[model samples]
Target: MELTCFKAYDIRGELGTELNTDIAYRIGRAFATFLKPKKVVVGWDVRETSPELKDAFAQGVLDFGADVIDLGLCGTEEVYFGTKFLNADGGCMVTASHNPINYNGMKMVRDEAKPISRDTGLADIRKMAETETYSEKAATPGTLTQLDNRAAYVEHLMGYIEFETLKPMKIVVNAGNGAAGPSLDAIEAALKEKGAPIEFIKINHEPDGTFPNGIPNPLLHEQQPVTGKAVKEYGADLGVAWDGDFDRCFLWDEDANFIEGYYIVGLLAEAFLVKQPGAKIVYDPRLTWNTQEIVEANGGEAIQSVSGHAFIKEKMRAEDAVYGGEMSAHHYFKDFAYADSGMIPWLLVVDLLSRKQTTLKTLVEQRMAMYPSPGEINSKVADADEAMARVYDAYKGDAIAEDRVDGLSLEFADWRFNLRKSNTEPVIRLNVETRGDKDLMDEKTQDLLALIRQ
Candidate 1:
């Protein structure tokens, strides 16, 4: 079968048909053959097919004479940690992330936990996976070892905050029945051991591969209510939820108002720059003004990078940025190998709440009002490029500045917008923002939608 799993950044596809144990094995051997590492770390999410696929991949690694460190069931960041913390040669995590039940995939990394995406090394791996023929050759059979990195991973996460400074507050954690429950429980225990008076209200805390609560995707407006309702009913100070692999986190305020990821980018940047003045903060181009304003106000430099984890991580390292965030909820830390961690974002936010002695709303509300954004809106069109081209044609002359950094972005005196094609789907995404004018944002957003949908 042809390798239809590889994408620009990672591998994802429908299970059984496009992805299976056999294909996974070939991918494993191909990864080994391509990277040729002495030892590799392997981890999987709490999915039904994850174990079998993980085993097959490990076998392929061993088949190519590479030792395997089996991390068993874990969030994606654990593999990243284990790869770096263990000083391993490479790593892989078998997780489809927030995809539906029928789909599954893998994320790979090389030495020092650098990502292996399409342009970097994934294309070569995909090509080799399709063309390589395995034979019983005389080579050392590699050994496999099981490791539980919970204590180490928790320690790493807690390193982002001082536990004693945290105030006594009730917070709700919605694990969504994915792989985040155990990690949260461990962190809670660590905080208690440190004598921090933080109380956790855990819901959907069990890890069931069946995803009985549905996928842990908080991007859907429907998924927000479950955690929001629980937070309000429990009288908690804040609510946090994660996707299946737990790589992305979404937050709700004490009043159970769901905060858009765009605002959180600014929130986290401010939190980081306050602690480290004159530091560099990296942000995606999709939603810019809020993040830029906050970063500069706090004596820091704001650098804009393209969207997606790989590009963000690269820019973070290059700029030595203290923190990076995407509007899609992926937050990257310079301390965390510039890699995005869903777990660390909330930890940092909680630290801010403790240090500032303020509510999340108090910190975010003014920023939200000062730079109103309508969030991202997507529309299907016959040709994404054609739609984007038409948008540029209509707005180019009037735009104060036009950039095609990642896609088409145009800025005017009162309003600005970015129109880009979705990396994984055939749709055009439009984002509109105004200079603290909600009505203008709404009007320009509707006007642009009318043009794009035509």
Candidate 2:
């Protein structure tokens, strides 16, 4: 039994062929056997298969004598929150995130919401699941309990921003028909109770597993325009969109411009630094100039971590970072058990808008101008290594410095680019940035794309 569903960081597979209730049960049993957890937290997204899978996984835990605390119908971060909040020994979230409609997956974590990446304990879980070897069952099975922590979680989120500072604003929130709808509704109710004077114009805000609209991934250039158009039509102060599981969030400006996640990183770094000066900020290596400058200029320390949620969380714990952000829209906070949250970023951004008396565009425009980037570009190729080799060979002579922290990063005086092969696909991603030269950035992006696709 080779578990083809196990990936580098989590579990993901298509229906019937790779994953089903049986495999999910085995995984739950294996998870319990490996961790010997006294209690486990479980949650699932809006995927049609997710409820059955969650029940199967929870049964495995119960059979192994570990109690289950089920937080029904929630996002991935909610499991992270529940694990730490309930003092559970481990947690699992049944969610495929931004994957296709036919796909489903699970993300696991240990006590205190620590991630279970391949290096930590995922490999051992996979092996145990494949072998189907389990410890003896207890005489009496563990009990199952249902808990709704939405109110507590919303309070925790609201703690990140001051209600008094929030001004009158109209915003568009597109849930893309995923699990975020219910949670967003809870937050909206909380805001109204406090008289926050914020108007939310919702779109595709139902939890439909069929995804009546396309999959809820705003990272796709084509999917972004829907939210952007809504922002313009509503005359919104800003717009926010989330993926299926709502772990990563994308933003749009007042004029309906899609703001790249790179610029948001800089904006957020400055926000944190303003309150807690001299704090450490962890950032991914894909786009560096803007984040580096902002962190340094604001009297904060900037640290670079290899891309990925597990790696970023590990680095944040080691460095005791105040915040960590990836160019792909993942933002982590220290107070949130070092877990990434799609909900926190927007709240904090809106709070900043009210406090600074500025718009999202104004806050990020100067930084965007200072460090121009075309965002991340992915190219599918026959050989990822060969494509990278060709790009490196073409620019090695003129490169002043090179860093291979997560991938290949070449830096010159005015511009730099990072090229890395995708972990889960036969594609290579390229990110290029220049110092205040959009034309140069565009030219280099085109040059690199030609080389990568050739």
Q: Estimate each model's TM-score.
A: 0.98, 0.99
Which runs of model 2 end up more than 4 angstroms from their true locations? none
Q: Write the per-residue lDDT of candidate 1 for residues 1-454, one digit (tens) a residue.
A: 5889899999998998889999999899988888888899999998899999999989999998889999888999989989999999999999999999999999999987899999999998988788875434217878999999889988888788877678888889999999999889899999888887889999999999999989889989889999999999999999999999899999999999899999999989988888899999988888798999888899999998999899999998999999999999999988877788999998888999999899998988898888889889999988888888888999899989987777988999988999999877889999988888999999999999999999
Give residue 431's error in model 1 in angstroms.
1.0
**Clashing pairs for predicted structure model 1, backbone only:** none
Please state the error at residue 138 of candidate 2 in Å: 2.5
Best candidate, TM-score: 2
- The global C-alpha lDDT for each of the candidates, from Candidate 1 onward, is 0.90, 0.94
Task: In model 2, state the lDDT of residue 241.
Answer: 96
Q: Tell me which residue pairs clash in candidate 2.
A: none
